[model samples]
Target: MYVTTSGRIHNFGAGPATLPLQVVEECQNALPNLNESGFGLMEISHRSETFQEIIDSAMGRLRRILTIPDEYTVLFLQGGASLQFYMSALNLLRPGDHVDFLVTGAWSQKAMKEANRIGDASPRWDDSENGFKSIPKNGEYSIRNDAMYVHYTSNNTLFGTQYHHLPDSDGKPRVLDASSDIAGVPIDVSAHDLIYAGAQKNLGPSGVTIVILSPWAMKRVGDDLPTMLDYSVHSSKGSLFNTPNTFGIFVLDRVLNWVEENGGLEGSVARNIAKSNLLYEELDRSSFWKPHAKKDSRSVMNVTWRLPNEKLEEKFLQEATIAGLGGLKGHRSVGGIRASLYNGCSIKSVEALVIFMRNFEQANH
Candidate 1:
């Protein structure tokens, strides 16, 4: 395992999660005077040419990494993916229009509730009763003929479940909340009409949400929509419709630069797979570790599991934190353990975690 000279421990928090050290360092350097423009990063004006170049670089790098279509519009908006839940529905739906959801976890549940405010949003497939341990196969759900679009979360951060295939949307437009696994996994940008992700997890930091809109989605925006919630408005202004998250965008751009330098999207996917595989292998090695998600639906980013009991789980968390590993606690909604192996999480960190798990299991058992 690679030990940090700066004495930073491994972080496994779900969001506002770990970031690449190089990116963090770059941000640190820019804090004083970004690009020697004499304006501190946090103090840089959104309308300034220097900041314009930063946003452009970030967007351009994101497009290249994801291979987003030329016609697709990308916006770096605030309010995170939570806002997109309502905004997406508000822009895409009118009264009486139907929308279908594949509710895999809490976030999707919240999304469905928000969408209901706009139209007849209902879950076509919901795995909540089964403890959100698996993703539904295509045939398990049915889409309504009148459905305007089919929405699904690509990865459930809390439950450690992820979809490994493109969902069957019955030829309807597909809207996705890829918040937890945007550039970290394999995604066909052309397949979905709209995709939104919170940059904190796999991209950079909180306060910025990336939204991609297909031409179809843009044209479908309801007339007289709220100016800020309207996609076309942001698209017209190049995501500068408001003040924007200048600091977050700058960090995100640095993170993307790190991705490009290390190996683009393919590299990120491989690294995440390798990290998750190491941890999952340890979880599978002993009965002491009970993984939350089913094998077929396991997440490559966040790995969730449990110990023999709450006492053991608590003991594990405490000891792990003392051992220089942190943020392994599970979501309060489903208490256990969760280690998020995002793009920024190093393989060395996973290796260190696996070693800790092995020692803890043996000692506790």
Candidate 2:
């Protein structure tokens, strides 16, 4: 159940999750000198033929896996998903235009705050009262027909909650900050108008953000926004309108290729479900531990749980760390423990974690 090869259990931290060992090794060998070019990827010119190949291949592979339509363009840019809030608002909504925001967790709240910073509308949602314990369970979902665009965090990384299914908000363009869950599975791109993610979580490393958007969104860049701040213009001009994070894009290409080689999106999706099942089933079978996330709202990638109280939670986290399952500390807002089992963490790692949890329960409870 342990990664005896490296003598460490699989890591479950939320963002910047573990990547394939093969991919890591490949990078280690190539990084000292990239592709016989006598320089590391970081040292290469993004506009040079070598780096352009890496970036283009990344875009192609990502398109193939996601089945992105021709009408959409993929841009690898900087500033993380946070900056998308500004770009999205600027591109689509005017100063007084309303944007319907979904407040699901800390991430979504942050999105709203950022949205407000860029525009005047406030987040209108029912998820705040219970601290996002559960996604609103209403049988009906109504869209504010006049909103510029509907923004939602598809997966709440901090609280281990997810929209089990995409909401049916008719006729409105939907924007999702999929920073934590990008490349975890296949998505129906047709359903969304725009989607953005920080590459560090599951793509490769920090310093870049992947944005996949439809051509329809281009028309929505209603104002002649700032040169750098406009997505529609950026996409029209290609991502190379300015200097890019060359190495980040290269590493992203390597990781996306790794995902494809190991059975593509369908394969990754299967692995994620298997990994989640292994951990969730064990938690379900135990009385000593309970899941903090609601059953229906549970996050497949970020699983969170709590001990009896603060004292127990403290002991559990420390003990869990000593047991070699690192990055289990919960976000301050949630204050329990979070295990972000991203694509990189192997199945063996999760199995080891399950074993450790069972042992901890037997001894303490």
Candidate 3:
């Protein structure tokens, strides 16, 4: 396994992925006595004033970094993006309401299935037959005229595909599950009515999910919704309707602080692009590297590919783990190899990966 002199591995897991060393160190420091308040990071009371300050800072920094509209409401909740898959539909949709989904990958397919529980959810565009290799262009699908909203996943972690442009929603509201590529790529916050992402990938650790909602989305929320699933309830109480993931929120805040200090969203986007380009360059250099996603649909955050055969792929993963290039294995559903380059991943890690890839190719070929 490849180990840095600092004793850290080059992490490339999809979710709960890499984090900035600085953030991790800060969390370590805070764990003993948070803000010198005689409270451990994980033991602090969620209702305490100090903890309140941490959550407030996190929300404010996220808004600034994402350039969220002043009118939009941001909530930090638990249960990850999976819960949001159901809660978003529960809150924004009603019985018999029609919703169109652009099923680019596995996550969107799940999102559509959850939405179908509440309303008529139809796939406006599904790429499953094509192995989810590419995203659709604007005119590639038709949104139902009476659709209540359009739902999509901005990035497909399982398939290494991403939408480079905002999807066409036919002027209807858009809901996005941006679990894998939220802050690592360019996104138009104002364009989406509702957006949810689990913090494990680009933002921080697991357990905390970020939800951003426009005024229209809040306005559209049906009455008498379940308290925990209701956006309005969570927004009204500032996401403190119930006890939250204190440690995760604190870590997330530190991650956002790191992002702000390192040139904010623009810096992350450029770095991610550079990292993916390095891997894609090596992939294109030889037919031995078989990338899963098409060129225009390649994801900057999660890069997936295969070897010439299953045996070689297994050999590659074994050697990769032995070399300390960790978390290079792909999702089990479509196993091959995947390298996730989230916001906290550095260019140095990418460089190491490329060098190792070249060496491996030479030895194996």
Best by lDDT: 1
Residues 302-341, candidate 2: write the lDDT tens digits: 8888876788888888887777788898999888878887
CA lDDT, every prediction? Answer: 0.94, 0.80, 0.92
User: What lDDT does candidate 1 reach at residue 137?
Assistant: 97
Positional deviation of residue 240's Cα in model 3 after best superposition, in angstroms: 0.7
**TM-score of every candidate relative to the true structure:** 0.99, 0.95, 0.99
Number of clashing pairs, model 2?
Answer: 4
Compared with the true structure, model 2 gives a TM-score of: 0.95
Q: Listing every candidate in turn, what is its Cα RMSD in Å to the true structure after a full C-alpha superposition?
A: 1.3, 1.9, 0.8
Give candidate 3 regions above 4 Å deviation: none
Query: Candidate 1: deviation at residue 146, Å?
Result: 1.3
lDDT of candidate 1 over 313-350, digit per residue (tens): 99999998988898999999889999999999999889
Cα lDDT of model 3 by residue, 86-169, tens digit: 999998888999999999988998898999999999998999999999999999999999999999999999999999998899
How close to the true structure is residue 146 of candidate 1, measured as C-alpha lDDT? Answer: 89
